[model samples]
Target: MSPRFEPITGRYLNLTLLGRPHRLYIEEAGQGIPLLCLHTAGSDGRQYRGLLNDKRITDNYRVIVFDMPWHGKSSPPEGYQNEEYKLTSRGYIQMILEIAGALELDKPVVMGCSIGGRIVLYLAHQHAKRFRAIIGLESAAHVAPYYDVEWLHRPDVHGGEVSAGVVSGLIAPTAPDNHRWETLWHYLQSGPGIFKGDLHFYKVDGDIRGKIDEIDGRASNLYLLTGEYDYSCTSEGTLDIAKRTGAEAQIMKGLGHFPMSEDPQKFISYLLPVLEKIRGAA
Candidate 1:
């Protein structure tokens, strides 16, 4: 297996969604129902940059990834709240529409991790008919108070750099030294704003757990992927969502929240079954 991923350049573009200018950067390859990949907080679509190398991924689906508003190449509008960045589930759904129009992609398979995963559930609840399938990798609807409170006040407890460093440690224990360093550096670069934004998003956003039934009301395929070690969301939490949404769930062994960075091959392997379902639906 090669560590290097060939660079894929799409027509650089922008769109206004959630009242922010969203800079869309894409690496499009293969052909089928598009799989729009969204990254967790502090990272951009580049997290999936290497996954394109996998023949299974590239041969079967058109993978599209972009920086969310206020993340990476995307910049936040002036006076924009972190809430704008951590958008309510509805905000995220609108974002998908905005991004799709910007890129001229029809409703595609929506795939996301962490907060991105949460977005998938929300979108499914609102417009299940639009998507062919929805995949949530390590997703959840709520955060534990103890952990949330601590992280909500993280900087005061660990100082800015240490807090960022702690997050970096969570990326990939098996990653190359430089990769780990870069991953940590990525969080620090996003800084305190993202943390505040994420917390605000969590606090203000509507819980889709109760509304998950709306998702199951449709024929869309729902799938959940999690690292066996991903402490961010528990198996129980994911299973609960799966059961409620009538979705299938899988937990990959020996991984954490950032599975794409931790183990892309395993990530894609588990994703293959779900992809087959999505392809069949199309």
Candidate 2:
């Protein structure tokens, strides 16, 4: 199929949520049912650039992506730079709710990766009626044996370089050279300690094992997709979450932590089937 040749539209808007004003960078393409994408921690909406440009998806859906506060072109509220930016479940949910309201999205399908993935479960559990569905990429009920946070804070080492070293092993060994490097490139450009701060939420505060049963798949169409090469949040762990939550789970082969960026074409191949299933259910 010929790729969607239409240009993506982008804008910066200030959203006041949770008692703060956040200037967010948002992008969108196409028109139809809304597809809201959340990026992996320490990264930005750039991960979904391929999806935004894909005609097959855009033809049927309006794909929206945004850089979270302090993550990309988005800027944190005043005085946020002075304090540690830890992502709380409540705060994260509020941001999504406010964004959805502002965009006037009608029960958008929410998809996220990593910390983003972990939060989608919370979204489903806390506000099932707000979303048409929730898609989790590299998500699990719990993540253990957290990575070294000190290394991410060391003065001698560049945080980006250290972050790259930490994540390099998690990408699929078979990933294409360009895609692999592109995934690493995002890490290399991330703000200092941002990855570690995000992990504080992903591995610590985001554990949903105790409440996984509260998520109703029939209400929100919860789905989990994990990469075969992801040891951080392994397929086994994701399957366990699915079993507990009664959500459908799939293991994508030849993919790693950053599926969309590591291999967009292959990731799309996997996503299309899930999208079809969701549409049928809707």
Local accuracy of candidate 2 as per-residue lDDT tens digits, 126-208? 88888888999999777885656779866899989988889998889988999888888888988877888787887778778
lDDT of 1 by residue, 1-282 (tens): 777746465555766776756555566777777888888766666677656666687787888888776666766665765333355666767877778777777778888888887878877776667777888888887655334434533545543454465466455466556545555555666644565465455545645566666677246677888777766666778888887777888877766777776566666677787788677767
Q: Which portions of model 1 show Cα errors greater than 4 Å?
A: 1-7, 19-22, 78-86, 148-163, 166-182, 203-206
Candidate 2 deviant stretches above 4 angstroms: 1-6
- In order, the Cα lDDT scores of the candidates are 0.69, 0.86
Looking at model 2, report the run of 10 residues with the lowest lDDT sum.
145-154
What TM-score does candidate 1 reach?
0.83
The C-alpha local distance difference test score for the whole of candidate 2 amounts to 0.86
Error of 1 at 54 (Å): 2.3
Query: By lDDT, who's the top model here?
Result: 2
Task: Score candidate 1 by lDDT.
Answer: 0.69
C-alpha TM-scores of all predictions? 0.83, 0.95
Candidate number of the best TM-score: 2
